[model samples]
Target chain A: MLFKGIAASHGIAIGPAFLLKVEELRHARRTLIDSSESEEEILRFRDAIISVKHDLENIADSMGDVVEGRQILEFLLLLLQDPTIKKEVENKIRCDKVNAEYAVSSTLLDVMDKFNIMKDPYIRERVADVKDVGRRIIEKLTGTEKDALNNLKQPVVLVARDLDPSETAGLKPGQVLAFVTDMGGKTSHTTILARALGIPAVVGLQKITVEIHPQDLIIVDGIHGCVIVNPTEKELSYYAEIREQFQEAESLLQQANPGPALTEDGVRYELAANIELPHEVEMVKSLAADGIGLFRTEFLRLIQEKGENEEDHFDIYNKMALDMLPKPVIIRTYDMGGDKFRTGLNSAREANPFLGYRAVRIGLDRPEEFSIQLRAILRASIHGNIKLMFPMVTHVEQLRSLLDLIKLVKNDLRVKAIPFDENMQVGIMVETPATVIALDLMLPYVDFVSIGTNDLTQYTLAVDRGNPKVAYLYDSFHPAVLRQIDTVVRLCHAQQKWVGVCGSMAANPLAVPLLIGFGVDELSVAPSLIPDVKKMIAVVTTHAAREMAEKSLSIETGLRVRALVHSYVIGKYPEILLDENDWKTGG
Target chain B: MIEKKITVPNKLGIHARPAALIVRAAVEFDCDVWVESPADKVNAKSIMGVMTLAASGGTLITVSAQGDQEETAVETVVEVIRSGFGEEMI
Candidate 1:
């Protein structure tokens, strides 16, 4: 039987289902302890308090390498030791003469009740942490080890109803093959943990835990969100072969060039890596990227000291530029919002964060933080390898203001006697339709343009990528999206400014040809995809790509466009298409 | 009594980190600190009360204090709110 769910972490795992049986919390009745026993009750509560405190501090102190564990644990520890909350719980035990477990659980319920009704997702999500602490404290007092995922006999597909934040911390690397959860969506802590663990996962199957039986044979296809349960031996062998072919092909890709991207036909394209965090630069270097394509420079603003100044920004940018060394690093001025982050004169809260004050919009409206960023980038550009870019360019005014801020920062640096590259190349992302149509108005201000196809497709199709129901409509290969790419590339070339395509479309083997045909000068892909994209560019001639791109415009539907591109790539290399059926249907 | 009304500006509002910071600062003052949102009033030092207020970004909330350090407590707490926990600036 096949079940569908959200494909979270990407991989394949075949294992016996190890159902994470979560035994319900079994606590004693809320009977009043005798007056003589009351002192013991308080003592028990005190001992548990110390135990829970030690537990949280241990987690915080030894945060080892959880990307965002220390700060969160610190916050949880503060919540655990709040004097006001301590007073409330103490009052319940002393005045009511109730058992410690009873008092603690009841007090947490009061907080949980309020959180359940909160409109803010961030506040509401904390309800889990509050309950985690409450449960931990109660377990210590009661000496109960209910539902602990402690030991496993062997590696198995760990399935659960709803994974708590605390439970996931105990997941040993090789003991659990993959994660399959019935609750929580794609961005839940469970999914994040799964991705971090580098395991196959499918979440929000709704009744996966109920349907999956222990020791049952299951194949988790993380790429397609398909879970095959108790498959026949024939079907099992088919998947095994596919997995082998995939790994073999991947190893072959690893042997591709570790140099600049030059097509076999001799056309040069900048194959850069998309880096969201600084740590990812190591992988970019390993993949041998020509440069950093879309450095999400906004993330540097987060998890930072409150009063970090221009020097702080300079430190990070300088390190990145030096690391890449002579390679152009296009640092986007924080395209924040829509699950990224909100900083710099813009609050995260908005009726419509996707469409509202975010990215360059906030920068133009209030230039305080924007000015600082410009100065930092300008100073770093003195290395002569850094290229600055702006996101969310829907208006000519936004681009003008952004350039104006760069002007102001340049003047400030000169006054401070700081030398920088006076002619640093500045660029804007042609993501929104307005920017694409108004290319003539905006190109004069920019030295290069990159297409952020992810957002462009979303806005053009009027589909929210977060809304799974309509997410299928948010295809980057939609004919209209292709037209937008074609227009941006064509317009940029006309003005003698370079254009690059970034995002998933740039890396997709099928979409790579279209982007090249659209006259994109660069393909900024994930570090892992850089080698594969470079190899594809090296093989495909730009002339044929342009011909295929022209024919794709006349295509009516997004499905046909995807098929067209798939067939074009597969016609040359049949192994590129896994199914081998996509090429046949394209005709 | 010292009182001031301020807007919560950080995007995530008074989530976890900001709530903890506010509580930490509140306990340092030798005064009774209270946060009054449009829906409910809560003790500023209590993480639950502060979080339960569910003040999203841009929500106007009032802070009041009464005691020896009332003037400083209210002033400090109000700044934290209006500042969006320093996320609005560098």
Candidate 2:
């Protein structure tokens, strides 16, 4: 049976599968004898660990440039220094006459068992890492070797619940046709590695392990989130046709690059990219973005260590701004709340964290802290076209308070004679229902506003998007959500403030017409989706979009509004319907 | 011995990491270090002592150290305060 899952990495191939099962561990409860043989065994085990360490260092030295290789080195170092492992070995040496090899193996098994039984998926995956390291050590100690996939002459599709960083590095790109995982997300290490390797992959397939059989003749369409298992002749023929069409479409899109994002009727739309990390600057450059629409600054502050101070933050912001110089980079100041900052920020423990002290609110509550960030932002503004934006503003007073704080910092800088761009444009994210409704009050205060549709939809619909049970209520096309977006867009445009949308919906082909119709100045989407969204925008007419936007805003029900907008767009542009089909089928 | 009272301007009080950053800065001077919050006082260099204060953002505390470097320690701690303990959120 065909199984569908989220496509994390893109590509396609057919190959035999190799399954690496978790090893069962048996503990050596017997006390070590003080005999000479036991002492010799201890010496052997110690030598084996030393050899394993040497092997790890060798691998690191050989593949030092690769991220996976670096990660293996990091894991090996952590294992070598783990106190528990040391304590276990010391106990065996003191109590049992067993050799070091047996003692180390026993300790490794204990650690693997402890990690394997963990309920957290992230922690549980560490068992695989432990095993990978332990296997190397055991091999070195026992001098017993088994063929480690080196003998598999045929190309194989690797299937796993998830591949640890170390395991992923050992995978030979030439021999591995594709990757299929039962669990992962877009940001998973496995997904990132697969994408980097340019191998086709599908992840978050909760049932892939149970459903897929050995050598099932599976076809994985990573782009479309479809997997075909034991396909019939008809399905096989259909997929071949689709594969050809997709290749042609991709080549056409490639040719269309570095061109104006203009419709056939000569309407131009600014295509921008939303970025979460500084590393994604390359992606923006590759996509040829007009600018970065929403540079989420929270990532810099969310590292495992202490949150970045003003200086560290300034360095990052300055680097990104200068790297993407000449292009207007709108950075949304730390939007830490919900699931994103739950563990990272100590202040994010409130019952209703989404509506609690976060974003500009946190900044306002603590002016000293707020000033540090403002100073960094204002300082970075001089390096490039750095525009500051506040997220989750529910009231006009909040914006006023935030603006006042910025002004104070600016004045302080002025007094201190620190050079700064006093005219740096400020903006607020129109994400909440309160903010959208109070657009008139908010319009005159900020230089610009970006509609963060993801949160706006969730807030307007009163739904917690992360909760799967209430996910159905998180529709962006719902009439109320559309109306809110339309209201803010219209208000911002009337006030002469260039309004943009930075959200998942902005990149959605179906929503492009409505956004354009609402007269949004810019549509910022994920860097990867820019070409497709631009392609759709090129086919759509501004006037038709405006009409559809009006109709959508007037509707009361989300389903009705969605149907009306979808039908109108499809009826006016038949090519869109075809694109929609292709999109659904992973075309 | 010199003692100067100062409020924690940073949002997350003298937490372990920030406390460590503060301790590193404080130990640069030769002085006996102690940070006293409203509830208790702790050795500025002791990570456990600093954490016990449970000082959060905006909590006022006094920093005192005794020795020849007392003046330098106090000045350094005050600088951290003035800089909001280098925390993004004060």
Q: Could you say which candidate leads in TM-score?
A: 1
Error of 2 at A395 (Å): 2.1
Candidate 2 per-residue lDDT over residues A476-586, each given as its tens digit: 777787878778877887889999998767866677888998888998876656777778788788888888888777777666665665666566556532323222321
Give Cα-based local distance difference scores for all models. 0.76, 0.69
Prediction-by-prediction clash tally:
2, 17
lDDT of 1 by residue, A447-507 (tens): 9998888788878888776554555456677788899898888888889999988766786
**Model 2 iRMS:** 10.4
Stretches of candidate 2 above 4 Å error? Answer: A6-224, A227-248, A303-306, A347-351, A565-587, B1-90
Off by over 4 Å in 1: A1-3, A6-10, A13-220, A227-248, A342-348, A577-587, B1-90
Chain B fold agreement for model 1, TM-score: 0.91
In terms of lDDT, the best-performing candidate is 1
| Candidate 2 Cα RMSD (Å) | 18.2
Q: What TM-scores result for chain A when each predicted structure is judged separately against the true chain A?
A: 0.69, 0.65
lDDT at A533 for candidate 1?
76
